[model samples]
Every structure is written in C-alpha cells, then in structure tokens.
Target: MFSTRKMWLIFLLYLFPYANTAQDIIFGQNKFTEYQIGNMSLIITVPHGGSKQPSTIPSRDCGCWDMSSSKCFFTHNCPPGTIKDSINCKVSTVKDLYTLETALNLGKEIQKITGGYHPHIIINHLSRSKLDVNREKDEATFGVPEAEQAWDEFMQFINTAKSYSPKGLLIDVHGHAHPENWIELGYLISKQNLDSGAFTAADSSILFLSKESYNIPFETLLRGDRSLGNNIQEQNKKYLCVPSPTHPGPSGGNYFKGGYIVKTHGSKDNGQVDAVQIELPRWIRDSSERPIFCAALAKAISNFYNFHFK
Candidate 1:
C-alpha cells in the first residue's frame, strides 16, 4: 500500500510535469520578483532551488574536479540519471515550490481568516547548482561574479523591506539532508571575533517556531538526551539531510549542520528584521512521500506564522 505521503506525491507529480526534466533548466543568478512588495510583512528566500548552469560552462564541466579521463577515473562519466536525480532530490518539486505558491495563495486565505494583512515572498529563480545563497560567493562553484551580484540584490531586498515596514520579518527557505526526518529552524548569531554590523558577521539568535522567543516545552524537546552527533546519525536513518556522510561538531551533531543562509541573514539586532531558516528532510517530499510532507509543511508554516506574526 502506498503511504499517504507517497500517494500525495504521485498526485502532485502529475500535476507538475515540468518538474521532471533538466533541459532549459534555469539555475543561478536568477531572482523571482513576481510578488508585490508593499502589501506584506515578510520576505521568503529560496537560495538553493536553482538548477540552471552558466552558458559559458559546458555540460560536463565539473568545477575544480578534473574532467580529463586520464587524470580522473570517472571524468565526463556521470552515472545515468545522476544529474536528474540530483535535481529532483534537492529542488522542491512540490512543497518547496508550494510553500511560495501557498504564501501567494495566502493573500486570499488571509483576507478570509483575518480580514487582511498578507506576507510577501522573494524567491530565487536559479537552482542550488548555480549559486547557493546560503554560502558566501567564495564557496559557490559557478558564476562567482554573478552570484555576488545576486547576493547584493538579496541584501538590498532585505534593507528595502525593512524600510517599508519597521515590523517586518525575513525568512530564508531551505531543506536539509538528515536521517532524523524532522523540521529544523535556525537563527543567525554573531560569530566570535567578527564585527557585528557587517553582513559577514554571524547572528547568534535561536529561532523559536512557537510564539514565545524561547518556549520551555520546545527547548526541552530539542534538548532530549540525544546529542547532536546521535541526532544526525538517527536523522539519516529515516531521512536525507546531507548527500554523504560527514562528521558533526562536538556539541553533538555537525557544528556547521545549518547552511550559510541561516547563519548570515537571521539578525535581530537590526530592529524590525527577524530571520529564521527552516530545514526539511527530502523523504518528506520525495516521489513516494510528498502528500504527507505538504500537509506537515503547511501546518508548520501556519504554526510558525501564528506564533510570531499573529
């Protein structure tokens, strides 16, 4: 019997046929500016959903890794379905895409629920394969120069939104590859030794999904005897947080488990702009488990918004 999640995923796969291919798959340096700005209270960014490759870069040009068949054993030889699988595996074919769609849809839902007050979304047109918004330009493999320009645009968007409303919020949307298969929220903190005002400086605030900044119940749940290391291993058993095996930090799991997007944009010191990063496991929305994931995501977002924005 198909699991409820898998059943829902099949239904959506048919609903969105365009998600299955790689041709003309636009990726990096692309920004989606479709939503209206002044009408909302939040900004949503998806930095890793891009899949487009640079025109200058060849199809098989694996950056840094030698493609020459002589030097590398697997040069120019990717396994069949590797690229396609990677795209489908990482990109939000349904829920990721649906999250933004639903926010837009929420414009109507809000009008119905509270008589007004909707949120605005700012998403990247590019895929994670192009430029990872979460990672610094130096860390990206393609369009390093263009990615910098995109990053500037992202920051500018945040500044502009704050200027429009001193009470607005910014959210960086993302997914994680882990074994636990649960939702994770991350906040930015000022990394030790870094200037507080600069974008490079990390913000060290804990993101609370519940209304209160620090919910005792939630904190206790997160602090369950399981160390971070144990959490990662356990998470991977049922979900996909990272592509491969990696060691987490001493605190328990990988110290750098959260991406750069969460580390950079989540700042509370800059009045009126609060940010949080959400990480969803792939199993939740895979071809076999999308329905269950979508419902869970919708509920999570609703809970998160109500806790903070309501």
Candidate 2:
C-alpha cells in the first residue's frame, strides 16, 4: 500500500501542469491565434496595446537626431531647465496589456457565440515609446524611418482581410486618458486644404469611437451612477457632422480631437472598409475596476458586431 504523503504528491504533480496550461490561456502569454469560419470579415487592430519597451530606446530626452550619432535621438521641444526624469512623458503601462487581453477574450467569446465569424486582431509587439500608430510618418517620435515598414505590416493585415471581400470591417482599438472620461466614435473625412491638388480626393474613411461619446458614461460613473450598467445610450447631439453631447458653443462636450489612424484609413466610398477607433478611459481598466469594466466593454462590442454584421 502507498503512504498518504506519497499519494498526495503524485496527485499534485498531475494537477500542476493542467492548472498552468489553463492560466496561460486566460493570461494570453502564448502567441495570438486567429480564427475564421463564417464569411463575415472583422479585423481588430490594436495599435497601443503594448507593454514591452524596446531595450534600444531611451526613456529620457538625450539630444536631437543627426546622421553622426550611432544611437538615434529625437528632440521633444521641451522648455528650458526641464529635468530629464522630472519631465512627464508618455510611458508604457501594464494597463494596455490588460485592455488588449480583455479584447482578445472578448474576441474569442464573439467567435464562439457567433458560430465562427471570427475577428482577426493585429497588436503591436513593441511599446508606444518606440512607435505610435496614431501619428503620420513624419510625425513619428522614434521610429521615423520604420514608418514604411509599419505601414507595410498594416497593409498586409488589410490584404489578408480583403481576401474575404465585400463583407468586411476594421476596428482600431485604443485607450485614452481624458479628464472627463469619454469614448469617441466617428470617421475622419478629407480636409481640402491638406491636399496639394494631386490626388483627386482622400481614398479612405476610417471609423473612430470618439472621446466625447465615451466620456459621458465614465463621468457619470465617476459621480457614482451605476443604474444603466452597460446599456448606456448615445446622446443624440450633433457637432461638425458627428454626434456630440448636448452642450452649446464650438467646443461641444462630445467632440474629441480625432487622431491619425482615423484620418488615414477611413473611407465609405472605397468598397466598404469601415475603420472604427475605440478609446476606453484609463479608469475603466485600472486595477480597481477591471473585472466589471471588461465585462461591460465586451458586451458593448458584442452588441455592436451583432447589430452591424447581421
């Protein structure tokens, strides 16, 4: 007969491997997987969903970029006497990873529930400190030369989605840090002034979730209102051809300064590539409120896909 301690040890050895595997799936340390079954094509692009900062990049301002320097440095145009460490610069946070993981989980849920209308996701392997997806090639802070390479990756993802054709949509996921805590949604149209009379018109329409639309629920929630839950309705106010919160004057409550990704890829006229940018407030996925916020966002996106795709 076996001793009690020996039997217990044997049981644990078998159990440990299974437990670790389950944790890995939930935590998403493994490589991202894509699923496809139904004809509908929905591509989810997460530009800022990164946590690993490149070892090659420096966190503090060193100097301006020049040909001679072996390691490239970019100027921030900071005011004089600013301490390198004291300067408030955008840095990568674990929050971004959590948000992306939540999005992946939601995507999986959508795939299973929708019977294989799988949503493809593209996430940046490097942190925003290295590159920002919302900026133009010229405006990139660090990887200015790599802009073409990044664009190539984006195009490749688009091409893969296009294989399905006709019934396709692109979702650009992001997070925002705004005082009012809003989520913005809309598309960027071509401004006539920017064109040098070269291209006939802007070739694309990028759909974005704006800060104004998103801020309402977050502001309300911060004020301790939880009655509506995730069933919050869009306030039917208008500003600059987009929906805004019902407040007067040029600076309407719901109007967010839309970013580059929205401006670049959004076009309704060009064979139905709908680009929607979603900006979730920092507090939504902050350490304290992540579980509830994740559920709420998952439900929101699920509802959006079901309604639009069907």
Candidate 3:
C-alpha cells in the first residue's frame, strides 16, 4: 500500500519514462554537463569552471575582428591603426579557476552540516572557451548544435532542481581575480545603486525575501548582521565580504552585480526561489585556504537558511 505522494510519483515516473528520481548524479549528452538532484531546498551552479573542449563543439568567438587590416585579424590583438570590425559577443575564454572544485567541496560541507541532506549541484563540464553557459544562447554557443543541446540540458537540469526546491536558494558560483581579496556577493544591484542607496526591492535578485513575513528591512537584509555576507565574515573576520555589515558596499570599486543565471532564475522574474551570484576571490578558490573557506561558506549558508527560510 503506497502513500498518496508515492503513488503520484510512481504514476508520473511511469508516464515520463526518462524522468530522474532522487538517486545518483546524472550526466547530459557527451558528458558536457552533470547534475545531482538533492532533497535539500538548495541549488548550486558552476558555469565557467568546465574543462571539456572537444572538436565537436566549436569555440565561441570573441567577435572582434579587424576589417581594415590586410590580414583581417579575427583576434583582439589587431595591429595598430587597424579598423576594428564588429564586436558582438561578451567574450571571455578564461575559465573561473577551481570554481568547480570549490562548488563540489561546498556541497559536501553543506551536506555534513545538514546531517547528510544533499544540495542540488549542477556543473557544466565543457570548457568556457568552447561554451560559456553564463551568456545567452547565440553568444554562449555561437549557434553550435552540440553546444546548443548541452545548454538546453544544463538549463533543464536547473529547472528540474527548481521543481524539487520550489522556494529555495540558487547559487551561481564563480572565481574572480579582483585586486581586493574579498568575496563579492551580487544581488543584481550595481555599484552605483549600492553607493547611492537608490536601488529598490524590484531590482534585487532576492526580491521575495524582502516581502517575507519577517518584515526585515531591505537594507538590513543586504548588509546587516544577519545577512549572508555577515555570516561568512563572522566565521573569520579576515575573510572579508563586500556588502556586509563592515563593508556596506564595494565603495565605487569593481563588482559583478550578478549575471544572466541570477537574472533569469531569481525571484525578480518568477518563482519564490531567490538567486545569488557569488564571486569568490582567487585565494579562496586556489590556495590552501580552499577547504577552510568552503567550511565557512557552508556554515554561513546554513545560518542564512535557518534565519530566513526556517
């Protein structure tokens, strides 16, 4: 005698033969992307840390060409006085160093904190030079069929994870090489907005959080003692995070202000699940401090969950 929920799950599985249940991680075609479905209401995506660069999928062009040059250079290193051609794509081929490893370790740490509750993890295994999943379809894959299919698969996995965690957090992880050795938490608000304090809840990725029953002030949620940045900073005062209680904002410095993944999936557009783009510093992702940072991040995320979601 199956419970109603179990019966419904079984019926749906029967109807959709290719549907995935709560089990081991699954890979997309050609192993371009992989996903781990989790019981916990959290999702993490690593878009720029992929390493696979097969010939089947052509590299995404930078779209900067020298039309006036005799050689007609397609690269950015065009000679002096060469007339620059169209520059269409937001081209960056360099991979976010060690972000995939950081994300994997972060998931493990989170599971340990939650007493074995898994967090949905999605990783794009393809190299950013081959496919930039962070960009839009045309620019990301450059109209390559294989890359297109992989992109669809990656997006579908996120959608599937969203179904499991209907009202949770989606974290887009990446590593940055900014001069300042501090973490950057992007909420879809620009540096100018943060400096001027002119941003509204509607401009935030976690828009739904401001409207929750707790009645938390928007500014407090962004950089107060209970915010995610503050939690991470509390773990170790040395581990500075911009937009925290101490930092407040970037203070007219460089900041990511979130990206396409957060913009497309965050609560601002639809659904209750808020999205956050976390740009980790190079030291946190590349040095001996990786595990330490991962632990702190896991604890901070858990604290955030307990404070807000619980």
Candidate 4:
C-alpha cells in the first residue's frame, strides 16, 4: 500500500546507516582502553595516566605544563620562563603520577567499602606522549590514523558508559602538582568565579548535568555535604579538597578548571550525566600514599551517590 517513492526512500534508509544510535552499540572489544560495566550508575576515567608510548605515534608538539609548577592553565598562569602555549595545552600531559594505580586501587577499595557497588572504570593505557586521549581531533590525534582510531574508540567507550548511567555521575581523574596537599575539584567554573560566587549551573563545565537544577543552589552542590568534595573531606584522609567544606576555592593558588574529557562526555549543556574533574595532588596520588587516597575516594564516591544521585 506504499507509494513507489516511499518504498524507494525506505530502501535507501536501510541501505545507508545515517548515524549510530546509542542503543545498539557494543563496547570494549576494539577499544583502546580497558572498560568494565558496573552495578552502580558511575564512571571514572584515567586519561593521562598511562605509561606506554608506542613509537608509532609521534610525540605531541603541543607542549605540556611543568610538572613542578604551582600555577594552572585556567587563567594561563604558567610561571616565568615556562612554556606558554597559545593552544592552551598547558595542563601537565605527563601522566598523573600514580593515577592508574590509584584508580585501579580505588576500584578495589570501592567494592570492599561499598559492599560491592561496581562502577564503570576506563583507563587509557596509551601514554599521553603518544596520543592525548582527552583532547579534540586537531589537538588530540593531530589527524594521525592510529591516534584518530584510538581517540574514537576511547570516546565511544565513554559514550557507551554514559548510556549505563544516564542520570548519574562521571569522574574524570588526573594528577596535579600544586603546592597544596588537596584535591582540586573542577566543575568547569574557575577558582576566581567560585570565590566570587559568579557562575550558574549552566556556566558549569558539566553542561548537561547542570541543566536540570538539582533543587539546590549550584554553589552548594559544588561543595556542600551532598557534594563530592564534602564526602572526600569528611573521610579524614588528610587530603582536603578545594571548593569543599573547608576550602571554598583555591584562594591565591592555581586549579585546573576542567578538560576535554569532562566537557565532551559529561552532561555539559544538556544530559542526565554530571561530571567532575578530580585533580589529585602528589600527596594523594603518589604510589606510597595512593592507598589512603584510594580508600577515601571510594568512600567519597559511595557517599556522594547515596546522598545525591540515589
């Protein structure tokens, strides 16, 4: 009963797949990173924590930040005599010290502490020196085929993970060498903005997550008891967090506002997934002290989920 034109259109539609919908997608087999499905609506990504640098991929000409600098890229606050990149690729590309170990360990700790609430964990095993998984195409892969493929694979995995937690949280983990012994929680707003209380949920880096007003002031969600920072603080692990119960912002110090991973895959601008970038200091991310931080992070995540998302 269909017209000839309609039938032809239907045939063409079947012949050409216009887009890949989130529903029918699969994961992990071809991904450049390791991925696992979990019982909880959560995701954690260790982007710049890999130690491998396959010579097949060239060293990124996009210079990185000093491993010892106290300043941050949010305000282009690189110190004198340091590399000032207009590309704004100033955040430390050097792997976040022991982040992979900590993240993996954190996962173990999470299972033990939370009575078995598994969360999807994604770790980019390729070194940043080879491919910056957290950056966009032009800057991320530099148009290299392998890098591009890896980038696509990583993103696909992230999107796939998001499908599992459409209304939950995403935590982008990284390392920082700031002078302070605290975790720098980035909600996309800068240290200056948080200090002045001059930002909106829409202004946050987690666009999609912030779109749905959580029935609480945006600032409160950034640091209150229901906030990720608060739970981490309450754990008494000694690694205090910025914009948390004790500290509102970095004050006179530096902080990473967020990054490509947090902004792109996160519910920035519009989605049910809220994402936060947790930049851990050496005191917490170092191999020796990682266990303490991992335990604290697991508890923080469990507490945050119970109080807010659950």
lDDT top scorer:
3
Summarize candidate 1's per-residue lDDT along 77-179 as a digit string, tens digits.
4443333223222322222433344333434444344445544555555444454556555334334456556565555545544455545456565655555
lDDT per residue as tens, model 2, 238-290 = 10111222211113344343456555554434444556565556665566655
lDDT of 3 by residue, 26-77 (tens): 6777778888767777899999999998987767665544444333333334
TM-score of each: 0.51, 0.54, 0.87, 0.79
Candidate 4 residue pairs in backbone clash? 206-268, 207-268, 207-269, 208-267, 208-268, 208-269, 208-270, 208-271, 209-267
- Model 1 residue 239 CA deviation (Å) reads 12
The C-alpha lDDT values of all candidates are: 0.42, 0.43, 0.82, 0.70
C-alpha positional error of residue 149 in candidate 1 after TM-score superposition, expressed in Å: 2.4
After superposition, which runs of candidate 2 have C-alpha atoms over 4 Å from their true positions? 1-39, 57-97, 141-151, 189-251, 254-257, 287-291
Clashing pairs in 3: none
Better of 3 and 4 by TM-score: 3
Error of 1 at 280 (Å): 0.4
Superposed Cα deviation of residue 303, candidate 1 (Å): 4.3
Kindly give the stretch of ten consecutive residues in candidate 4 with the minimal lDDT sum: 19-28
Ordered from best to worst TM-score, the candidate numbers read 3, 4, 2, 1
Runs in model 1 with CA error above 4 Å?
1-38, 57-117, 141-144, 188-203, 206-257, 287-300
- Best prediction by TM-score: 3
